[model samples]
Target: MASNIPSSAGRNRLAAPATPGAATTTTPSRRALSADPTSARLSASARRPGGAATPHARAAIRAIDQRRRTLFTPGRTRRRSLRDQRETPRDILRNLSRVLAPASQPLPSSSSSSPHRDANDNTLATVPEDDDDDFLIERPRFSLPLQEDEDDSDLKVPRSSGLEDENYTAHSIELPRRAWSEGPSRLGRESMASVRFSDYAGPEIQSDDVGIDSALFPPPAIEEEDSGNVMLGVGDSPERLDVEESRRQTLGRESLFGPIEIPDMGNETTFLMAPADSPTREATVIDAAVENDEPGVFDDMDDDHVNEPMDFPESDDEDNDNMEVPNDAENGNIEEPDATTLSKPMALATNRGKRRKLGKKISKHGIEYPSLPPGVVKRLATTFAKTSGVGKTKISADTLDVIMQATDWFFEQLGDDLSAYARHAGRKTIDESDMITLMRRQRQTSASTTPFSLAQRYLPRELLQELRMPVPVPIRASKKKSRAVDAEDDVDVT
Candidate 1:
């Protein structure tokens, strides 16, 4: 039976073939185990209770835990001293001792120093605690360049109490001296007290004698108009020479040309005078007209018959004289309807007046009804209220009617415009594309106009998008009236 039992190689031969469709997975068979020695070792290590993989995994987990611990851990900080944090108000008297007192000398102890010492003793340079509390000098930390060396143990001093002074080993350090502190220069001293006024004065006045000459300022000459002629013209026959003297005066100073005629100054008229000038006394006749006294046009006409009124005969067969007669009833049992009764209903529904009253009777004999249905207006009003976030508003009938009429007027104008646009496009029916195109054109043309701005607020979001890309819109066709039976049966429950 041991010889007949199947070996590992025989068991491998009995296993299923590795088809392409079957999943290719590694199985621990002796053949595979012999091919890869490392995988076999790994498998053997995983099977054992104390494996190398377990130790390595534990080490990796420890390293990750350590990293996480370090990342989340908070650091500890040392307590800060008062000097390191913020500098307080220092006692100037205590600091002055450090500057002025000798560094080599040790400070006298409180027990050694006598309390009843002289008032002027230099050892009593320390300020009393009460005085220290009353006055404190706050100096900026960075103001002084020199600082006491930290390593110098002999110069160190503790905080002063009431009367004890500590030894301060002051260093004998030289400070840089500025040149400006020496003295003022000679030039600077002179410039300090002097004022710099400009030497430039205004232009010199030119003397009249500078350009004046003999031609410009000549000696005065007197005109001698022969005294004899003056006396003879004045004394001899003054009346007879008046005309000649007047003519000579009128001629003015005689030039080479003859006497010049004085220009005429016409009569001055007031503002109230007619604009047309008076006709001239001398008439200029361009053409002579011959007037015939005899009457040839109406020689046989009588003067007595001129004032008589002409009589017009009244025509009885004119179109305006013919009146429309009422039609007589043809059926006696069922009387024919009156023309007024038949037309009253049709006339009432039509938009006759520019503004039709909401609840006015259009017919002389009919029931009064509102032009716009109240239910439709209420529906529109509720929708408006909901959109505007106005909770439960009461709209008056007149106000609603006015709003409806205004809306109707606006729609009518829009329809007219759309009709015009359709006609321009060579189509009687207006489409969505035409509406989008018209609105876009209106926005572009009248961007600054009021109408476009108002329309923009009311335009739909999709229509605004369509304005950019004039895409053909899919219009849903309205459903036709359903059958009474179908409608009744198809009614929704709630």
Candidate 2:
């Protein structure tokens, strides 16, 4: 048995070597081979079997593919099918009827031709139910007069109250009766003639219900003699009417005439209205005088005194002649005392000292004489005294200087008025009260001239209070340092 017989294992080994390129030349067994053919065929079919479908499946697939292709195509039957499917069932039924029904059964006629027809004539016409019965009840008709008469019969008549029982004559009736007696009356013949004229003038003559004559009414009339022209009411000529209307417009209705009374020509003491020719006469006479007289005819009228040079202390012969004295000098030069020493004296002699100093300084300096009258000087002195206080002492140099300058200015301004007052009243001194009044008058004049600047300059505390002008709130001093100190103390304590 061992003599040259190959085992099944050796046969397998030899078969495996025969197919060298296939997985190390492993050959399958007969049974494995038999099983693999059907599996391979199945695997091949699963992977890529082109003609393996059943007839029914292939038909279904074909149908689906045909439907997809048709659906994708433009203007295709499938798109038309989709549109037919989307149509309403009623439309479908309608289409079906058209297709299936006999030609003898015609479609409905249009609704516009028949008033009672619906959109489709096949629909029945709708009717509204009567609703008047719910809202309206039956009522018997009766005449208002009959109803009122019946009511009057049943109801008692009320007696009149005595409050309104007195007879009331209308204003119109009283007006005619009252007015007829006021004006001049015409004779009966004249009245009859006027009435006859009215008939020719217009229509029938009829009085108002209140007995007012129609002739009295202001209305236009047709003139029989002058048919071409229309006549206005009596007393109304065209020119007169136009003038009256113009007057009414220019002067208001109440003032139809010019001003009834003229205004008073005030205070003719100083002012006079010269005769119209007087000015010409005066001018001619003045011209004649000027022509007759020399060019310097009024040279002597200049009474203004020239200022003379002030005289200084004579130290040498040359200096004495050169030291010119002012012409209007009243006193010699007085040394200006020390400011501190002069304070009390200055306060006591504020008015007198101020005037004297100004007068002496002006005189010594040979300044032009201020023709200050005695009254103005007294007024300025009094004003200074009043403002500085009567008994209060210790005056400042600045205040004294201001007083002196102000006094000088005041005399210069009111020189003419002061001269008149002094000449008329025979007064030599001006007082503080007078000065204050003059200052107040000046302030009033200045305020009128320059309101805004005056307001700013004179914004005193009293004025501010009266005007309720707001005062700024004072800010508190900073407490930051104190707070810091307190914080430092706290830190130290802690």
Candidate 3:
């Protein structure tokens, strides 16, 4: 019977292979004791002493047994499946709420909050779709306004303080130096003294209304005195008068001194004085006085005097005719001639020098044109001059040829117009416009031959005509009807 039981137990274990290995123990048949249900119960009762369990231990054992039952039973597995389904829906709702929630609310505090707390909180506070329409229409949240008093206080202090403390020191310093020490100052002083002396001597001297005295000197005493002896002192004795007159004349000469004398000619000690009969002496004296008044007179005179004989050989013979030469005098040691009273022949000679310079310049760049229309040549010359980048006085032969070619092309293109314009001007010439058109056509032709040129190839004559003519209004039916109505109204008004 035990062997059969063993076989049966083995078959049962094979049928239920999912049971724990510990539940299928192998023990010796000799030690095996089979007990009845009553004895089993008695043993269990003995283990519990009074057949009662302590509430605390009973609860603990019941909890452990419940957990085990839940782990093992298929029904408990079904309960776990239900729990998973419930958790999935909850997680989805939580994620949705989090995604839809406003960003401004403080992030849910992590301390006491569950991971899903923010989601739950957001869902509860979220407005429904129907409510949002009205909510969106409400005024948007704006930043808080700053106090006016605070802004005013900030602006006032610095501006008011700057205005109140406006006094600032500026220092300009100059170094000391001697005043009125130069030659100009000395001349000014001498002039003033001389003016004062003249004013004191003559009451008839001109005086300004401002009480400023102006000294006016009398003409030379020599012009008034026939004897050429005018006493400068009170003594009238012949010898004394002569000495005084001499002194006075010397002073006058010094007062009217001319430019500094030219350097002495080396080893030359000769004088050639103009004859008394000749007016050259008087002329020289007057010229010298006038030259003293003119600045830079000496520089001009030096060129003439230094090379006088070489530049003006004719002047030497004239000088000989006018002057009394001593046998001891050098050949070319002539006294300086008066610049102001230069003979008419000499003036003519100077003018001829200028004319010669002008003639040379003209020869270098003068343009000689064939007998064509007056303005035609001028216009051609002007155009070529402008295009050639050459001066008006120096247009080249090539430039002239270009101008002639341009003029010929212009006449061929605009012959009738050229004749009309020339007729109006009473001259037979194509003017500046003809030249311009020729240049423009040439540029166009050149540009057409070149790649990627911006120059206009053809004149837009039709487009230009259209632009000059006014645009006509389209005759629409509605516009015609309105115009008829307006005409009827005007007739009624009349």
Candidate 4:
């Protein structure tokens, strides 16, 4: 059986492969034993009994505590101080000296010898033995810096009947000297306040056999009186020292947040109470006509929509009389604004936005409404001007169509009249003679002294100016003397 036991070299706890009729014992490894949290190496020293873990501890220990919670809040119930356990305020005050005394301090030896005598028994004995109830401890004032040799033998005890001053110092530490206040922080520069812990840090005490070394705690560095930083004197209390400011300390609006801006509340502007969605001049005039109750009251106003018919509400004459504006009839009446005047401001204010939206729509969608192509009339007008011997002529958009109509009619009449005159003279087309005869007839009909003067109305000014030269007088048969006389003589001779 022993031969079948596994060796400890491989740290394995299983039995080794056994021969026939062989047996073995396998000892558990240290790691396998330590797998239990109750093992001596795994358990904390506090949990182990006698600072050592035993087998019985394994029964209660777990790898992770089953009852462990993330949050922990201990109970606040307390045994309370002896002073708090006392019944009355005067009783608590009567025993304050005993409560503050350390446990090591011996109890007061009373006149009646009792080792277990408490504060109440000591107070009762003191009251009967002595009638004087006044205290003995006198608090030393801050008239001078505490000397180097000074210790807690100084501070006055608050109460005294039971506890003695011997071996019972209220506080062990003594007050620091004025020079000892100088530290790494700006201690002396600031007023007595709720200061940092570092500001209170100063030189540590030297060897107890000797006293504090003055070299370790140096005097405060001298500051200029003109620099305005003040430090209290050794004898003076900080509460009584008054610090004078060079300038008044005040929080100013301009100083803290730069400058505050107050809005212009009383600014002048047109305020309209009425709501008008569409802003157009025609609507303004229409509103006026309605307010005045006259269909044509604002008809004289110049507007593009002036010719567009308006549908005025048909009212009886009695209603019109009732609606008549009272401002015209009564001398004492203060005029209330009519609807038209009220709408004027709103219409004017929204007019710019409407125009902007209109321009935006036209630009974005490229004029989707029914309309001629852009600049078509302009190009035609330019072409006509160029053809009529006036290339620099700039036509007005309002009068361009009218000018075109007049031009077409004028040319048609001139062409048909000239063609008729040519046909009457046995010709198919016009010659210079026809033009001269036409101009002479036009000049006579128009009562113009100059020949072809009416041609100026039809032709461009530049062309007519160039054609204003004198015409060659023709030698007519009526003007010829002998040549025309031969016609009379020839008729007589025949």
Best by TM-score: 1
Which ranges in model 1 have alpha carbons more than 4 Å from their true place? Answer: 1-374, 439-494
Find the candidate with the highest lDDT and give its number.
4
Q: Over the stretch 27-92, how does candidate 4's per-residue lDDT look in tens digits?
A: 111232345322322222213233223333322332122112111101122223432533655445
**How does residue 93 of candidate 4 score in lDDT?**
51
lDDT of each: 0.32, 0.32, 0.33, 0.34
| TM-score for each candidate, following the candidate numbering | 0.18, 0.14, 0.12, 0.15
| Residue pairs in collision within model 3 | none
Collision count of model 3: 0
Error of 4 at 369 (Å): 32
Question: How much does candidate 4 score in TM-score?
Answer: 0.15
Q: Which stretches of model 4 miss by more than 4 angstroms?
A: 1-395, 440-448, 452-494
Off by over 4 Å in 3: 1-338, 343-350, 357-431, 438-494
What is the per-residue lDDT of model 1 for residues 1-494, given as tens digits with 9 covering 90 to 100? 35534543353343322211111122332232345322222222222223212233223333433443343222212223322432323334445656876764543433223332332353246546444323234322433223454222243233222222212122112123223223222111101111111111112112211111111112212112223223343344224211212222222121111122211110000011111211220121111112223434223232222312310011111111111112233343233335533453344235222222332321111112233555777777877777887765767778786677665545545655787789899996898656755765767423223222333455666765554253332331111112322333444332
For residues 1-494, could you state the per-residue lDDT of candidate 2 as single tens digits?
A: 35323554464344322211222212222222234321211111211223212222223333433444344332333344345445656456657756765665433432323433322332323223433322133233332221133121233223323234222333113222123222232222101112122121222223211112222332223223222112222223223211212222222211111222111211111111111222133554465456545434333222222432321111122212112222112244433223322352344345434334444322211133533444554555665677787785434556655555665555545754544455455665653224334545667523222322233345666774543342231221123223434555665699
Model 3 C-alpha lDDT per residue in residues 262-352, reported as the tens digit of each score: 1221002112111112123355446556645654554344333342243235433433323323321345544433331235335545644
